[model samples]
Target: MSKKNNKIYLDFAATTPVDREVLKVMMPYFSEKFGNASSTHSFGQEAIAAVDKARETIAQCFNCDFSEIIFTGSATEANNLAILGIVKNVQKFHIISTKIEHESVLEPLKELEKSGHEITYLTVDKTGLIKIADLEKAIKDNTILISVIYANNEIGTIQPIKEIGKLLEKINKKRKEGGLSKIYLHTDAVQAINYLECRPDWLKIDLLTFSGHKIYGPKGIGGLYIRKNSPLSPIIFGGGQEFGLRSGTENVASIVGLAKAVESAFNNKVKNFKKVSDLRNQMLADIIKHSGESAKLNGSPKSCLPNILSIRFSGLSNETLIVALDRAGVAVSAGAACSSRALAVSHVLIAIGLTPKQVKESIRISLGKDITAREIKMATEIINKTIQNLL
Candidate 1:
């Protein structure tokens, strides 16, 4: 196979190319239907209708009311709104979160800590899963919220969301009986929508965050699901769009694109997941067969996102391997794209007990729905050759 024939994209976790169908649905909103959703005139009403329809479609996916969906500029913004908004009215309360969360959630918690709220950063096992008992111990009478990432971005280990939700439900019942404030659960499900079950009712989470681009939709659009009566205040104050939570003129085109993406994702979820997972399995088997003892799979062998494969090579640098793969027309990542520039040891890796050297030797290969068997085989061959060259 010619290396130049196709560019093997294995960085789906960073972002996915917008689906052509989704783009087609969004085109009219950009030019012909370009109107401010907040306006009341004809053009504006048309835009608002599109926005409402998108909200309803997404809400259906999450099993939430249309009014509960709050569209934001990005998943990072949704995470911030969920974390900061929940603590807006409280003066001093405790919050619980895992150390492996995305920075959007971590940074907001840090801000809350600075404002006198007690924050507990829970530790995870080597598999990147938190202990329910530990979480229970951490909850105090003043604990207000618990935020956890549904699926780890780099490692792909899925948390026990349903169990955590059930635990919280029991705890909330006790709190209500004691006349104490109920602790709410929020999950950043940006990486889970395509592969995992995310209905708010099923997960039993009070608040949730999602990004459009991660699911093959347009960039710069995301949504937050707030269960009715969930205690949250507005983080952004303005024209009071998005039910007074996220205020700004809506990104009508992107919202339309997001709805189309969500619809497509659910419509073909099973088929897409099975195909990508089979490809991932083939890639892993090939790497192990070719590289032997030098290769080691990171994260849980089971209970991981089918699309993500985090692998470590002993005595090799991840950056060098990534560069070599890119030169061979295969794209991959060292970790989250947002933190790639820092060149520091990944906190998620370190938290999972990887030594600094092992962390440096790890790379993340995420598969997309469009990937083919031929591309997987070609990429694996390129990776094996690159490793040999680097060694």
Candidate 2:
């Protein structure tokens, strides 16, 4: 057994600890190479070169043209820019999204709805998988966009983006007869990039958004990949930074860190995924073995990400489990940290058809590269004991 520590972090889905090497790369940008990338002097030239190198690395990770990547403040900003930027240019716009999308997607759609845009939230199955047929039927002439998450953050369900791409290709072909408006496909790929195989060119996504923090990079920096010549209006207007798409001075240090983190993560994606997934599987097996009939898996068993595991307890509440685990020196979450404070049931859980009781009883346990098999074993033991005592 490993030495017992009071803090076992398994909340990687919410965010990750920055890699030491990434931090090392970002250090000089903050103090030594500190120059506004927009400046014309030699100092600025170095900063600009660094940012350009980062941008190219990001593009290579997505296998897209370097010019297509636009750095933004965060994935939330990227999602907003992608959705609002596209919809603003069209009249009577319509969008198709899953009911279980991250609030970043749902809230923007809500704001758009309040602004008078029509939206149809496609329902998901019990496993949290959205139906492609539903998506197909929802595509109307006014459907300006379809924004689906590549993989869910809460439940770790991988959506059928490639299948949807094929469906859209067929629909786009037929819709050309009536001069139908071209439907743009966008995916919030923040959670899917490190954990899944995402080929934007093959998937035919018009826009893809990802954040650096989610993939073990610095927070507050992300990028959106817009297919060449995709019609998108600028949400923020200022000096022509990021092709005048995002107007700001740019967080040079964070951007540099994000780029390095994304590059390194993608480079080691396959090996990292296998390592994390093995730890997660061990934890899941232990949870079931210890908790027996009371413990159950919440997300898609087969088609989900290797890192995230949302477990449901039949009798105990999430709060109890989290508190008990924390006291025992294990850290987990009931859901997204953004919504962790609310005592209400998660919208993702509700969308997946879990009862109010089941939702309150559920807690999300996500793993990262830092998590070891020993840590997983300790966490599961704490969780089991917590549930037993709560009952």
Candidate 3:
């Protein structure tokens, strides 16, 4: 716990250490290009140009038109705006979301519930995948929106989003025949953006959300991709920035850094994919080989994200293991960083049918671009040894 023993950071899913190149790009903007983008002066015009360029870069990364991406304070804000914005103009007071959504999506849905809107929390399979059949059955006459995460944050399982999109499209076509308005589909791609293949337009995603910090960029800057002509309302009222969908002055430095970080991530995606996946499997193999039958993985090995490994130790609480690992110079997350303090069982695990005991025993270990295979072996050895001693 001391400064000298902070340990190797292995919790990339929670957040990554800023990439050095990204920091280099962000440094000059803090003072040199520091101008309110709304001003009419030359400095302001330069800032505006920088922000516009960043927006175009982000759109290109997502394979969407420049006008569709609305930068926000974070993906949390983007989720709020995407979900709440669509619901604001709707007479139908119903929404559908998964139980595994981050607090950002869940909190806004709760607020809508408080306003007397009906929201269905869908269940996922053991692999943390939502069944399309279940989704179809959950659809109601008043259901106006369906917001599912593209990939889970804790277990890192990628959802069947393309299939879900096709289903929604079918529903929309039927609605058109019935002379009824179609339900909108939104996906929180916050965890999926940099790690996997993501083409929002091809996936038929109406609104997609992701964060800058999650992808090794500056914090306090993220975005929502809104398909053109979508019904939405701005939650924040201000100087009509981001085409009046999101209000306020832009975080120019962070925006520029985010665009650059995203570009870097995409450029390294294929190489990182094989490297991280190999590291992830090696870590899992080590844990299983060393920890014996007590070790249990929470999600499907093949379907989960390449960078994340969620494992549970029988008779070991995550808090205990976290402290043990921290003392041994390894850093791993207990669960979603946001809910670690509440000591609640991860909603993600619970939704996937993990028992309460399994939930408490679980920890999420996410690898970064910089983590080496040797480091992974050491981390797993520490985990296995610590669990043996503790048990």
Candidate 4:
């Protein structure tokens, strides 16, 4: 890989560089304001106050009460806590999720299934969207939870989250009318925060998960929003912290950084979307024009995230393309960074109806907030050249 400053990074889906402004706000928390949030002294009180303010800022973004936010070490941890924690309290029940969920969500569901919890993995259409009817059909008398990804990390297809949420809300209402239990909705909103509306109440979601690193903030910090009165058992046991849901010493710096990142993202969302999406479109057009009939878009052009472009070139190896792009100083990925190391084709591609050959030919190009038109043009030129050589 090229040196950090030299490479044109188009892999924002994997992670993002922390913004300088966010870093500035986090500096004090690391040293000068360094105090255990649980301490009773003045230093501790100051740290705790900062942590509280951060929580409140994040809550405001999600349109939820401050008490509902529980900070965790990462989005993966938050996901595990939400899935395992919820299923722990229910002895026997059915859970519904889609096949394209992040590994964090899928692995936990597998564990639940092993323990005899019935799980229904919904299928997605060609556009990488789940049908509401399929979801409705999956629910049963013992249904406890329905978890879905807000926006797919690999393909960047935004699901019909609001529709699913509303469906669940109506179902819960019917269950209430019949004096039965209500089903809860959970969304892993990690990839959606930068480009989608994520207010929990508006989406009618009982649980939501997001992380900092994807939004130009420090890593090792993320949070889960639990609706009031939602039943959950603690996944980690230790000194009571985060309402006893996540127990550990608060990561003061990253927490503060997350708040600043959220504030920046929400404030400039409209402007950033316009700029990044235009660049993505231009890049896609050039890439398609250069690659000709051999190239095809992988996800729905109309319904996908603004900054992501997943495409496949017929008979081309994505692994070779990724390595060539990397050597050419243009960074991209074959799939989710978490699973990129595996030799197997992406589960998401297979789930969306791609054959094994098409899966091997696919690559993901995710845009960052700071990417420029010049950079996109140059990257596309490099990609075109690489594809030509590979072909």
Candidate 5:
């Protein structure tokens, strides 16, 4: 729990404060070392070198070639690039994604539908896990891409990406034998990158997208890993930067900060995973102890990311609880921060079979690496007490 002037931030899924080390390394590039990476002069050369190093760092972290990693403005942009980029200029095709995907992926898929592309929106079980059989059945001959969220942002239920990837690999081999176009597998790993296996071989994915801010890096920078031969066209065309796939002047400072943050987080993944999960488990137990029958935890605990908890308190309002918690100096959310502004119930919760009334009763409490046990204890008390007061 990080409290400044009595405020505890529990919304790590939305974004994270930039790590101190990442900030330290980014300082020079913002001032003395600033330069346009596209320029041909020494300043530009220096800036481009930093960019290359950042790319190399990401490649090493995700176990991909340097050329396969493409930096973007945000994970939203990366998701757009991976989804729209692959099927660009094609006559017609099909794609598959989950009902629980972030708007970044869902919106693009929706747009593709307007352009005559077929999309299959797979449903999830009560625990928010997609069925592999459903996905296997959704494949059409022209199905070129399948984009799934590696871990849902709201409920934090991790989809079986490895199983899906292996299924694709086998299907692709037979498709090759049959002379059909390859069906690329893309996972929006923005939420899963911090706590899951991301190696391309391990997941058997053709494309993976993640955000910098989600892992304690600065905002405005994200990364995409494209397999060596994936056919992706540029959605943003300008100066032909980023190996001609994403064209724009590189954001040197955020790029370096992203790399440093990713390297640090990826290296400390096991330790951080255990610590955050332990804190979250303890907090869950405490919250459940108090709320008991009134509280219902929304997703599979075993399959979740350990940091995120979506819970509903019977007969209480999420909006009211959110206000009460905020007044008490604890920050939380009703659902994905991206969709928090909307009045409608979360599409994610609905897909998992939550009623509109239950959706209004639910709130999300996500933990960060900086959170301490004391903070969790305080937060648990505050949350339960707030519900009692509301009741």
Candidate 6:
């Protein structure tokens, strides 16, 4: 968690504040440069230029061509487009995905199932990682797509994306020679764009989805990287914007913000990772030192996001702890923010082998680049004190 004004907010996995540089680039688009990109006038030309430049900027950061970047409303929409769009007209085909994918990816796959498509949900280990053997074995002759999350939003478990990509590359080459359908790899990189390797070529992903707000950019704008010739049909239909993949008046301001944010995140990724990781590690040490056997870390300690920590405090309800922390001006989360209001235990925790009771005892604490040593110390003290009071 990082201190913002008077509040300690530890929910970076949910969203991040727009960076000042991003805001500076975006300010003109809202009004001064306000123009429908579809218009043929000079105003529209300016707007389209901004959109093109933003697209090119993002493409460079991801090591993709300008034509590969498709802007969408959100990562959810981008993810839906990747999953549902790929098999738009094709049906009864097999798709492989992980059990721990975000609702955006999972729900679209479920929709495909209703339309006679076969889906194989791969299970993860206790540490929330998919095995390459299990994944390769799941590939049937008819499998056309494999969608997995690069990193979990709640538990912070980083998947073996690069390895999976290489595995798919080999399998895909064989499939191509055998005249089998080439399996497309798609990763929901919403949690990884700010911290991890995001190059499409290196990841060998056919499609990639990410959001702006998750990377200190504005909301309502995100991008999809569709590798050249990867079969994907448009989900949203209209004036053929975004190479006909998504059609709408582009959110010009947010698109500009997204570009700047991506640039900043890539440029500062290493430095910020070093700093936040140290703070996160130290915070874990402090909390464990104070709470002894009461505090246990969830998720993979080694193969996880540097800034996120999922902790289970035995005999404590995560909901109660979140509310108590909210009262104390420290904002945390039980799981994914989109599904937090639901009464059901987190599907993520359940998939990772947590019992229903243990799920209730776990909370997600994801840090941002701005988190401080002082804030970490204060948050640990407050969390331990609060746990003691509840006990």
Per-residue lDDT tens digits of candidate 2, residues 40-108?
999999998998998898888889898899999999999999999998778788899989888888999
lDDT of 6 by residue, 1-391 (tens): 3565688988898889888889999999988999988889999999999999999999889988999999999999999999989888775699999999999999998988887789999999888999989999999998989999999998889998889899999998998999998899999999998889999999989999999999999988888999999889998899999988899988999999999999999898899888988989998998899889989888899998888999999999999999998888788898898898885688889998989999999999989998888888888788888888987
> What C-alpha lDDT does candidate 2 achieve relative to the native structure?
0.87
Per-candidate TM-score against the hidden true structure: 0.98, 0.97, 0.97, 0.98, 0.99, 0.98
Candidate 6 error regions (>4 Å): 1-5
How far is 279's C-alpha from truth in model 5 (Å)? 1.0
Residue-wise C-alpha lDDT for candidate 3, range 340-386, written one tens digit per residue:
87887788999889889889899999998888767777777777788
lDDT of 4 by residue, 48-123 (tens): 9999999999988888899999999999999998889988878799999999999999999999899988999999
Model 3 worst lDDT run, 10 consecutive residues: 1-10
Q: lDDT of each model, Cα atoms only?
A: 0.91, 0.87, 0.87, 0.91, 0.92, 0.90
Candidate 6 lDDT at 323 equals 96
Native-to-model Cα distance after best TM-score fit, residue 23 in candidate 3, in Å: 1.2
Return the top candidate by TM-score.
5
Q: What's the lDDT of the predicted structure labeled candidate 3?
A: 0.87
Q: Highest lDDT, which number?
A: 5
Write down the worst ten-residue block by lDDT for model 4. 1-10
- Report the C-alpha displacement of residue 160, candidate 3, in angstroms: 0.4
Task: List runs of model 4 lying over 4 Å from the truth.
Answer: 1-5
Model 1 agreement with the true structure over 241-272: per-residue lDDT tens digits: 98888889899999999999988887788998
Model 5, range 17-76, lDDT digits (tens) per residue?
999999999999989999999999999999999999999999999888999999999999
List the candidate 5 regions with Cα displacement exceeding 4 Å. Answer: none
- Native-referenced Cα lDDT, model 5: 0.92
Which consecutive 10 residues in model 5 have the weakest lDDT in total? 1-10
